[model samples]
Target: MPFDFIFNFLTNHSLSFSNPSTHLSYFGSRIICYHLPHNSHRNLSYRSILFLLTIDTLICQNCLLNQQLYASALLHSKSMILLFSLPIIVLAYVLCRNIKLYYDLHRRGLNPQFDIFGIKGLMWLDSSAAHENFTRMCSVIGDKTFSVLRGATPVVVTNDVDLIHAISTEHFDCFHSRIPEVLSDDPITSENIHMFSAKGERWKRLRTLTSYGLSTVKLKLLFPTIETCVSEFLDHVNSLSNGHSVVINHSHSLFQNHTSYVLARCAYGHKEKNHRVNNFLGVFSNAFGAFSDFQKSTAEKITYFFPEMRLIFKNSFVGHFLQSANQQKFLDYLLHLISRFRSRTINENNNKPSEKEPDNYSLLEFFFDHHNEKKLVEKAEGQIDMKKVKVEKSISYQEITAQCKFLSVAGFDTTANTLTLLFNFLAHNPKIQDRIFNEEIKSHSDKIDFETVCSLPLLQNCIFETLRLFPHASPLQTRICTEPLQIGKYEFSENIQVVINPWGPHHDRDIWGDDVDCFRPSRFEKLTEQQRKAFMPFGVGPRQCVGMRFALLELKTTAFRMLQKYVVKTTLPVNDSHGKMVNMTVRDTGTIWPTDKLGIILTKRNT
Candidate 1:
């Protein structure tokens, strides 16, 4: 008891002693520890400092005591040495590993150095001003292609059209799949891994299934359902307009109602419900809302920046934490919808419409049939290894949910941003709006069917030009190397990230002429060979967006209806500019978005 009390008193009081050696001597080892024998060596586990000091005294008793005291002094010095050295060792290992990775990338022609061990880069990426940061990144690295260290991962980012074409098309086999940011291998997330993440033959099969799901006949069938939704949107607009110019984005999002209804009918096999529990769209909106701004968790911030952390994070509690709470509303709704669709599919008239869901031959039902939901529903847990999917006749159930999730997001966010920017451009350029009304809108009948809108090339051009400006998702698209490959003179290792920046080439003076910054739909009229290859709003080649035709239809149909009835005007000045929409700011939060409020003036037109 006396020895324990002495050890505690000395160790606890040593905190304020400025010099560690002096503090150890002040422990009065001459008085207390002089009874023990002197032996320079003593064995004590690293787990406890108290045990270390106590054992040093005991070991000394077995030998002989001296005036200078024995192993007690040695223990103090050794414990302090180990404590001080550990952190420096850790810091050295971290620095060496990062420097080695960066050096390898530098040798491969990735230039100008990257953020110090990616700390600064991580902060910049996690910041909401990613677009602005990218512009700054382009300035330092130049407008052409360059590689940078995204954490320790080697990411090749480029605006080079030839290189983009070569990788995405000509050299497709070498760079076909993406490294997903969030690592998820759950039965549903793995099989239903969104379009970009699935690699090789499995990816090809998924694309085929999705492409078939959006066939011309299916689009034609789904057109009426979409048209009806758009009409309701226009009616809502009319009620707000009140026979005068009105702002479209005050109380709620500009296109939220319109997109929600369309997704409800097309993806959910039902009308959009207004109730809190049943409204899948509302729940879905709120779930992603959790990621907005500063709400991001610590685990999310780490994994989002480091692609290598995907596998580890997916297997952790953070993944569950993210899904169980923030996403529960939508997950519950999705499961409910799945149950309903499952019930209906087993009935006598499986392929036909039910009285309750007149538009029951939905995209949801179509995807389920292809996935062979019967098998998927049996084993709904654990992930499917996509690499060995040679004989798997159908995708799993989780794959079906994953597909619908992508559709819900892409179909809503991307199409919404395009419409927002389109309105702004049209509002500022009255002449272009007038030309569309006279040449396209007036030529067409009152009907806004899929076939009628498909024939409007000029209107289609406007949509193309707007997308050329804003792009389909983020200006940044990503892929990963499947094997050792060469692009130009640079040879890359397998699993390297290949980022395609559509923003750079889209605004390149060499490709789009000096008026590249201008909002001119006419530029798309006369295209050079290079320009056509450079234009990749919905990605490129076989891996391009499967819903391209559907997206175009939505744009044309919505634009036709809105333009036919209203003349758009906005708060922005019409002078000294060709629709100079520089006042508005855009950013990428997984997808491109207009951060400013989406408000435009709509004057009802009497035709």
Candidate 2:
């Protein structure tokens, strides 16, 4: 239509603006014209007519050329304007965002803070002394809630017990999930989802279902499983030391294997020895080791300071590291356990008259049976649903697998680290070891059961103090605010990162006096209510370690058995090495452990 309009307008150009003698015609899709007015065509020579026609054509061409030039000039001017203004607009936006963030943090009592670049917040990335650095910052800042940029991510590190209690419990709805759920392509790896990673309703459901397994009654039933493993652990240690002082450089490995064996029996309901079990232990060790390495890496640290690089880290090396073969193997082992348990359930159902004892139910079987009962309840309720919405109340097989996997890793790693640290402490302090063995544990040697061992106050204090001094989980809890809330005088907005520094309070001079760092198991004997609450080796509040009860039972059981039979000391060069005292240091993986290859010497007790 535009072409037609142009053609028609051009054809009428002579009539509109020039003499009528010049006429235009459309012929063979081309414009042509001729003049024949008053028969004067002969007077005007052919060259003259041709010259006139050329002049007219030039006028039309000039007009079109001017129009095209005007449009091109206008477009170029606009382009130039945008090019110059774009950066200014972007800079203005960034400045506003930074200003808002700064003001928000300032209002919350965090001022003079590091920007997202992590100039100050990157201190925690220093694995050698991250915890100490963080504490130093806490002391210097004189604020319980101080702000730091983690690679551009804003993190509020807190040492205030009240604030920790508030965020972790009082305002739990606003601060629930930790890191965003990592999506994995492998089904087994995906099964890594459990209470730790779950949020909202899913977390509630999973926590409730698994809580049954760790209940006092349930733990009482499972005590035999724990005792058996504790017995085996003592035997292993005896064999390893051979009634002589033997140096153990890898105490983590020793305790880790012990915890894994106990978890295997209680959680998976299997006592059979298998290659998969060893592989399973190695899988977690490798995965966690890799994760710790990744967290402490330059790339990950930089990402914290510069949040923009998170995608790059996630898509590149760090991302692949998370989905390591160890992770896959861990997932596979979980799947295998789930498969075995489900198969057992099928066989049990088939033999209806054979009435299996409830005491024999493994953690997995309980979850499965509980889920079935929940489904029946949901089905019955749905029959009278007012909305008629079909609610899927049945738990997925993957969910069950994830819960098992979570319990296995969380329970095993933290407990193993604690036990290792405890043994190291006892090895270095033979006086304390004697107190634990001859005083605390010897009384129960005749009938060493869960109740009897747990009844020993000194033994309990030993566990508590060991955890306090070397809380395996230093920054015990980390959370992100999901909604706006205030902690004390400080205001928090959504997505703000919060961390509870358990190590800080545990070692604070003011809280425990000048000798706060000293290994004093007696401190726990008369702890104030605040001090007792402040001592959170297993964390505190609703999101505190769900398996805490079980972990304690496991720890006491192991400690009682080992201290009953052995005297632990350090062979490392230090004063009072033989009598009881020994120097100790720590190395940080994800969680702090005794420095790698730090040797602990164990000798059989002359009972």
lDDT leader: 1
- Give candidate 2's TM-score: 0.74
For model 2, residues 237-352, the per-residue Cα lDDT tens digits are 66665456566777778788888888887888865654324655776677564323234555555555446756677663566675558667777877887788778778868887
User: Candidate 2 — worst ten consecutive residues by lDDT sum?
Assistant: 377-386
Q: How accurate is candidate 1 locally (lDDT)?
A: 0.67
lDDT of 1 by residue, 376-492 (tens): 322211232333445344666777777777777677767777787787778877888999999988876776656787898888888888888767464336777777777786677
Best by TM-score: 1
TM-score between candidate 1 and the true structure: 0.79
Clashing pairs for predicted structure model 2, backbone only: 150-304, 150-305, 151-304, 151-305, 151-306, 152-304, 152-305, 427-568, 427-569, 430-580
Kindly give the stretch of ten consecutive residues in candidate 1 with the minimal lDDT sum.
376-385
When superposed on Cα atoms, how far off is each prediction in RMSD? 11.4, 8.3
